[model samples]
Target: MRWHKRLLAAGAVAVVALTSAACGGGKVRGAEDSPQPGTSLSAADATFTYVPNLDVVTDWDPASSYSNEIIAMENVYESLTRYNPQTKKAEPRLATSWTSTPDGKSWTFTLRSGVKFHTGKPLDAAAAKAAIERTIEVNQGAAYIWGAVDKIEAKDATTLVFTLKYPTALDLVASAGYASYIYDTTATTDDLNKWFNAGHDAGSGPYTIDSWQKGQETELTLKKFDDYWGGWSGQHYSKIAFRVTPELTTAWQLLQRGEVSFVQRLNSQLFAQASTTPSVQTSQTPSFQNLLALFNTQSGPLKDVRLRQAVQKAIDYDGLIAAIKGSGVAASGLVPGGLLGNTPGMTPKQDLPGAEALLKEAGYGPGGKQLDLTMTYAQGDSDQDLFVTLLTSALDKLNVKLTAKPLQWTTQWDQGKSKDESKRQDIFIMYWYPDYADAYSWFVNVFHSAEPISFNLSYLKDDAIDKEIDSLPELTAIDQPGAEKAYADLQNKIINEQAAVSALFVQNYQRAYAKSVEGYVDNPAYPNVVFVYDLKPGA
Candidate 1:
C-alpha cells in the first residue's frame, strides 16, 4: 500500500490559485502612512533592529513554542538543517549530510565536523541524539512532528540515525524548522523546563543571547563562529536587537522613526500605508500560513454535517475580501491555492439557497433553531477582526446567532491545542503555514484523523480519511499524478462530507530595507521560514 494508494483507499483530494505577489492590477499598501528616507549604517558599526510581535512566549521549548516571538530565539539557536529559500530544500546547518534507506523507514545524518554551542561545548552525535529524544519526551504538543521516529541512535561521534516506525514522506522537511533544532544535551529536562518557564533560550546559531528584559526587549550579539561551515566572510553585522511591540501602530511609528529595520505581520491597511514610504520597500512571499475557521464538531449543533455545510455555504468570500481591502484571495478548498494538489479557479459554493436547505434539513432553518456560535481571533489582529465581522454578517442572514470573541494571542493558541478536550474553544479562526511545499503537510498531518494536532478542528475522525492521509508517502513515491489523483479524491470527499471549510489562503507580506538588505530573495522551499544569514547589504 503506497502512500497515494493509501490516500485513495482512505480517500483524499486538490484546487489551485494564482501565486502573484500583487493582487489584481493595483499598488498594494505599505507598513507606514508615509515614506521615510532610508537611513545609513556604516559597515564598521553593523547592527540590525527588528520588532517582533511580542516578548518570547514564556514557553521557550521548540515543541511548545509556536509563536512568532520564538523566531528571535531560533536565530540564536540553529536547527540541524535550514530550509534554502532559493531551492525550497533543506540544506545542512548543524548536520553536514544525511541519507535515508530506500524503504524510508531509517535515516542517518553526519554531524558537522567542528561545531560548538554558545557555552563552548562541542556538538556531537551523542548530543544531537539527546536533543532529539528530549524534545519528543518532553513536549507532547510536538509529537505530531516527531511521532514517526521509532528511535534515535548515536552511531558514532559524528553520525546519528533515526529509525521510523512508519514510512513518512515529510520526515526530512518536517524536521527542518523548529522540530529539528539541536539543543545542549548537558542540560537536564528540568533545566530545559526552567529555561522555557523563564523565557530563556540556548542554541548554537550565528547570534548569542545577551539580555532579555521581559516584555520590553531582547538583545543579542554575533558570536563570530570562526569555524561556521556557512562561512562568515564579508558579513557586516556584529549584533542584532529585537524589541517587543505588541501594538501595530506603535511598531509602525518606530519603523518610521527608524527605530527598527524590520517589522512583521502587518495588516492590509497598515501595509497599504507602508507602501508609500520611500524608506521601506515591501515584499511578499507565499507564507506557510493559512487563516481558517476551526469548527468544533464534538460539541454544539455544528456536529451535524448539514449544519457545517450550511455555515460553509453562508460565507461571502468576495465580501470578506472587500472588507480586508488588501491582498486576500477567496479560498475555495481546504488546501491553500498556488501549492501542489490545488486546481486553480475553483470557486467556493456561495449558494444561500443551498445553505438554507442544508440548515433546514438539519432542523435549524429560519425560525426553527437559533444557532449561538462563538468565533475567536487574535486580540490585536485587525485583519482577523475584519474577517470575523464579515463572517458574522454573512451567518446572520440565515438567522444564526454568532458571537465574536477576541482572545489574547497566546491564550487562544494554547486553548486551541488543549489536550483536556473538554476545555477547547467551540470555534476559532487559525492559520497553517506549510512546513514544506508538499501537499501532505496541509492534508495528511493537519486533517488526518490520527494526527493528535490534526488541524481538523472539526474533530472529524473518519477511518477512511485516516487511511488516505496515512497512504501519502507510498502514493507520492510511486507516481506523482497518481498521488495527486488520490489526494483529489480525498478532497472531494471532504467537500461532499463537509469536513472543513476554506476561508482564504493568507498572503505573506515582508518589509525590509530595500536591496540594502542583500541575500533577501524569497525562498521557494517553505515560504514561512526566512534565513537571516542569507540577507546582507546588496552590492
Candidate 2:
C-alpha cells in the first residue's frame, strides 16, 4: 500500500487527447513499424499505456499513505536507496553511497550531485533532511520503520548523517516503498497538504504528473521529466497513462488489440490463453505477496488452540492452489518465497481424519455438538471466492456450519478491527505484502501484540512471540545464521505448536504485455509496478 499526486492539469488534458489517438486500437506500432531492439526512437513514437485492474490511487499523500497508489508513486518519487531483490542488497538511488559505524549506530550518506526536484529546487542534504522530517512528523503510513532513528543531521550541503538508538538495519528501512520518498520541502503556499492533494508534485523522479481525473478517463497520466538525472538518451517512453479497467476481459481484449501496452493482472484462464497468443508476452515470477487466514484468537470457539489447528488441517490446500490456476503454491510459512525466513517443505499436508479427531476432542463433530463459524474476505477477488467455496465443502465434513462474507477492503478491515469481540468474524482473510522487502513486516505487524488493533487482526498476544519479533531486526542485521534459526523456531511455534493463524498460498506475480513493449523485467520488491523509464518500443 502507498499513494501520489498530479500536476499541470492542462498538460494532462492535452495528453489525454493524445492518448485517445494512441491507445485503444489507435496508431499502435505493428511488427513492421517497430524498431529493432536497442534502436533509439523519438518521444512521439514511444508512449506507454497501462491498464490496472482497479482504481490504483487511494491516497494522494506520499507520507502516511499505505495503499495501491505505490504503482504510481514509485515512478513519481525517489528514495535514498532502492532494494535489489536479485542481489539482496540496497542500491544507490538519491544517495550515491553510504557508510555506517562499526557498531551500526551512526551512518553517513553522500548525496548525488546536480539533481533538482520537479519544482526547480536543488536536492541537497538540507532538502533530504527536511523531507524525511516531514514524513516522520506526519507519522501516517509506515513511520514505524524509522523507530530506531534517534536523530538526523545535515552535516553539509552534500552529506547527511543518521544516529540510531540501537544497532538497526537503516539501509533496508531507508529503501522502504512507503514513507521513504525524498521530496522538496519548499512549497509556494502555506497549505502544502492542500497543494499536494490538488495535483502537484515535488520529487526528483524520472516522470512528473501530467494530469489526474479521480474517477474519470485515463485516471492518471505522466510525462517525462526533461531534467531527470537518469537522462532520456536511451529508449524511454515520453508519456505513460494508467487507465482503470476493473474487468479482466476488457483489459485482455485491449492488450490483444494493441490498444494498451501492458495489463496488470489476468485470471488463470485468460493467462493461459495469453501465453499462446503471438501478440502478447507474458511473465511469471515469484512474489512477496501471500494470502493470510487470520484466526480470531481473542474470542469464540477458535480461542482453543486445538480448534484452530483443526480448522487449519480441515482445509484442502491443494484444491485451493489448483483454484488459483497455478498462480501460487501452498505457502511454507508466513514469509513468502524469494525472501528471508521462508522454509521449503515445512507446510503440513491436509489430514481430514486428523482434523475430525481434533474437532471431536474439542466437542464439535458428529460425536459432539456441531460447530458454527464465520469468515470474511475482500469482495471481487476471484481467487479468494474459490478459497471460500472449497473451504465450505471441507468444513462440512467436520459437522461445522461455515459462513463466508465478502466485503469491500474498507468494510472488511473495519469489521476485523471491531471493538466488540463478539461482533467480529471468527476468521478474517486478507493478503499481506511488505512495505519493504523484509521479513520483519510479517513478524512485527501481523503477529505482534496490538492494543488498539492495527493489522494484527488475529488479536493474539503472546509475550514469547513479541520478544522474538522485536529482536528480529537487530538480530538479522548482525547474524544471518542466528536470525534464520530464530525465524525457524518461531514458525514452528506459531504454526505447529500454537496454531495462531493459517498460512495460505504465496502469489506468483504475473503480467501480460503487448509484444511491441520491450525491456520488461519483473521485480517482486516493487510489486504491481512497471518502471516506464526502462521500457521501450520493440520489434
Candidate 3:
C-alpha cells in the first residue's frame, strides 16, 4: 500500500479482466420475518432501495461499458488487483500473486485456487486470456486502456502472463483496474454483442441482475457463494433495486419517506435536511472528480496559447465558489485534491489585468473585434446556470462576450466528437472521473498528446510535457523523491506553462441513507459511487 504521492502518481487503469469466485452461502436469520419498527429486515430477504443518477445503463458488458458515474460493479463482478480505497493500494482480489521481469515488460499472475463461477465452471488462465482478448476485440469505448497490450499467454491453468509492447506500468495494473473483471469463460458465447446485451453475462460474483426495464429500474438479487475463495469485502444484502429519479426533489423525498433506502448524491439543501431528519443519516466523501471547462486547443480562437491563458485567467474561480454557495473550494491541479499527486499548494488564480494583457498580445482585446465564446453547460442544472451567469458577468469586463449554451448530457457527448470545426467544442464544461485512483488516469487520458481527440478534449500536445509524462513510470520505479519532483514539474507545466486548462473545484459528494442501513463505505477511489457488496442492513 504505497500511499506516497511520488511513487503512486502513476497508477494502473488497464482494460483487462480480473475475475472473482467464491464458496457456498452462509445466511444468518434475523429475529423478525420482516424488518421491525426501527430495524433492518431479515438478512435472508433484505432489500435496499436507491435512486440512480442515470435513467438506464445501456450496456452491461465489462469490455465495452463506459460509465464515469455510479455503476454496479463489486456485487456482480470482481477484478484481479483492485485499489483498496481505504489503503490506497492495489491489493489482491482475483489474482493472488504477481511478478514482473527486470525489464518490466513481461508480468506473471498466480490465480486463486478453488474459486468456481456461478455457472459451475472454474476460472483458469485461459479465461483470463479470453477476457483481455475480448476487450481488445470489442474495440469499444474502453479499448484505449489496452492500447499497449502486445501479447498475452496462459502459461498454465493457474498462471497468466502478459507482455507489453512498451515499458509502462499500465499493463501491470490493467488486469486489476477498470475493464478488468473476468467472466466465466465456460458459459460465454462467441457473439459478444448478443451475449452482453442479452444479459447472459457469465460473471462469477455474489449477485446477478434479476430483472431490468429500460428507463424504469434495475433490480439486482444476491446469493452468497459458500465456496468463495476470498471472502466478501463487507456486509452483503440479499436484494437491491436501483430506480432513476431525474429530479432532485423527487429523489430526496423518496429517501426521506423510506421508499428508497439510500441515495448516492444529494444537493446542498437536501444534505442539510438529511442531517436533521429523524429517520435518515448522512455521510460525505470529497469526490476525486476533476471538473473543468475544456478548451478546444485544435480549433477556433483558442488555438493561440496566449488567448487560452487569457480565457483561463479571465474566469474568476473564487467568484464561482461564492456564486455556487457550497462546500466546494478551488482546485489544485487536474488530479483530484485530498489525494496523492494533487499538488495541494498550487491554486488556480484569477489574473484579471494579466488576462487582458495576454488577450491583447494575442490581438483579442482593446481595438480588436468583439470576441464571443460559446460555453456549454448541462440543461436543467440550476447550479451550472448560476455559474454561467457569474461567468458571463466576469467575461463582460474583458469585452469578451460569453454565450452560454444549455444542453442535455447526450447532446453534449454528440458535440464532443471531432477536429471538424463544425463539431469541435469551443468550451464544454465537463468532469473527468478517474478510471482508477491514479494520477496517470487523469494526466494520460485527459491531457496526454498521444490520446485521440475523443479522449483528449483539449486536443493539445506539448513535446516537452509528453517526454516527461512518458518517463513517469521509470521515475517512480527508480526513487520516491525523484518521482515526486518529476510529477511536480509536469503538474506545473500543465497548469502554468501550458495554460491549456481552466480547472473548477473538486466536488464533495453527499450521500443520504435510511436509519436502518449501515456499514456503507464511501470509497473515494471510486468517488461517490456505491456497490451493495460494501453495504448491508443494520439495526
Candidate 4:
C-alpha cells in the first residue's frame, strides 16, 4: 500500500480521500503437544515470522497510519467493530453491540467492560469518545470517514452515542481499519504522534511492541499481551516478527529454508511453485484492490479527450492479465469485483485500429506529429513495470513516445500533486483499495473533483460528478437500488463516456504459509493484513 499525508481545513466537509496511498491446503506436520495459555515455549515453536516484500513502516501515528504499516497496526490496535467478510456483517470487537435509528442518522454502541489499554487504563465510552475526537481533530489519513458525524456523546461508562448530519452507515465507518482505531487517549506525552513514532504503542490489542529496528531486516517484533481482554487460552504464537525482504525470490528462499513462517506475497512463477510443494500451503482470495492509471486531464497532451481515449484503447488488458499469469482479473469499471458499483460483463478490450484513428484525429500518429508522454509508477513494483512495458509496446504501433519512470512512493505522490502543472507526470499509476467496503471510496477520493488536490491525481473538477458522489452516502443508507443505479451511472460516465481514467485490473490477494501454521484466513476488506492472533502452531 502507498499513502501520504493531507491536511484538512477547519470547516470543510469532503468525502473520504486517501493519501494515495485467501484459502489454502497443505500437508500437516507431525503432531506435537500444543502450548497452553501463559506457558513458556522454545523460540522455534513459539515465534511466527513473516516476510514483507517492501520497507514496512511508512507512518506510525495510529490516526494517520494508512500505508503498509497496516499489516502491523491491525495487530496492535483495536476498533469498535470489525467487518467480517465471511458473514458479511460487522462483528463485535471493542464494542459488544450497537444499534442505529430508523432514519440511520443516530447510532448507539455498548462497549465491553474489563478491557484495558497497554497503559492499564480502563476502556470505557469516555476513552473511546476521546480517541475518536483526537482523530477527527488531527484530520489526517481517513478522518473524513467520520464526515457524517454531527456529534458523539459518551453517555456512560459503557454507552456511546453518535448523531449524524445525514443518514449514514456508521457501523461500516466504525469498522474501517484506518482512522477508526480506539487507543489510550490519556497519553502523558506532549505529542502523541511523536511518542508513537518513537516505537511506542498505546493499543489494547492482543500484541504489544517488543522491538523496532528501522531500515533493518527485522523491522518489527511483537509479543503477546497477557492482559488482553480476549484471553489467550488456545495455541497461539507467543511472539510475532516481521522482516523486510525487498526481493520476492529472497522471501521465497527464506520460506524454503524454514527461516520464516509466512510470506506476505509471491510472484506468479514462485506462487505456482509453492502451490505444488508438498510442505507449503497457498491461498488465492479476490481482493477489493485494483490498479488505476490516471491521465493528466488538467495538464500536458493528455488533456485532450481524444488522446486520453486513444491511450485507453491502446492498453492491452488481456495481455497485462496474462503477464501476471491470471493473478488478476481485468477490471470491469472503476470498482473491483465483489464490491458495489462493479458492472458485470464489461471488461475492456484493446482496439488498435480505434486507437490509431483517435490518435490521427488528435493530430498525433504516423501521418501526424508524434505525441510524447511520461508515466510514473511506484519503484520496485514488478507488476506495474510489466504494465508499462506492455502499454509501451502497444503505443509504439501508433507512433506515441512513452517515457516510463519509477520513483519512491512518497516522491511519486508528491510529483503527481506538484504545484507546477508542467512538472507532473502525464500518467500516474497507483493501486487503490477501499478504506471500507464501499463504492463511495472510489467516487469521493479519486473522481470527486479535488479542491486542494488530495488523491485526485487526474486534477478533475466536474461539478456534476461531485454532486452525484455527495448524494451517494445518503442514498446508499436509505435506498439500496437507487444508490446502485447512481454508482453504475457514475462509472459509465467516468470510464466509458468521459474516458476519465484507465482502470487496469483487480488483483487477487496471494499468500503462502508453512504447513505448521493453522487457522489461517484471508479477508479482502483488509488487504495485505494478516491476523496472527487467530492462528496457532499446528500439531
TM-scores, one per candidate:
0.80, 0.91, 0.84, 0.91
lDDT of 3 by residue, 235-314 (tens): 56767666566677877887766677777767778888888999888887776765677787778887777878888888
- For candidate 1, write residues 58-108 as lDDT tens digits: 345654444343455556667667665455466777777888888777888
The digit string of per-residue lDDT tens for model 4 on 1-539 reads 22442211001111232121100011111113222223322335678888887656667788878767788888989999999987767899999999999999999999999998987889899999999999998888888999999899999999999999999888888989789999996765578876777666788898887766555576677888889999999788987878777688888887776677899889899999999987788999888888899888888998898999999999999999999985788888888876667787668899999999999988898789999999988776778889999999998888999999887666777798889899999898888888888878888999888757768998877889889999999988888788888988898888876787888988887899888888899988777788999987884
TM-score of 1: 0.80
Error of 3 at 408 (Å): 2.3
lDDT values, one for every candidate:
0.60, 0.79, 0.64, 0.81
**Better candidate by TM-score, 1 or 4:** 4
What is the model-wide C-alpha lDDT for candidate 2? Answer: 0.79
**Residue 131 in candidate 2, Cα distance off native in Å:** 0.9
> Residue-wise lDDT of candidate 2 within 1-539, one digit each (tens)?
21111101000111112121121112333334432323322335676888886665555567765666678888988999999988988899999999998888898999999998988889999999999888888877787888888899999998999998887778888899888989887854566665566567788889888766555536777788889999989677888878777788988887777678888889999999999999899999888888888888889999998899898998788888978987878789888877778777677578889989999888887678889999988677888888899889998878988999987666677688889988898988877788788888888888899878877888979999999988888787777788888888888888887787787788887799988888888878777889888888776
Better TM-score candidate (2, 3): 2
Backbone clash numbers for all candidates listed: 40, 4, 15, 4
What is residue 398's positional error in candidate 4, in angstroms?
A: 1.0
Residue range with the least summed lDDT across 10 consecutive positions in model 1: 1-10
Clashing pairs in 2: 1-67, 2-67, 6-199, 64-141
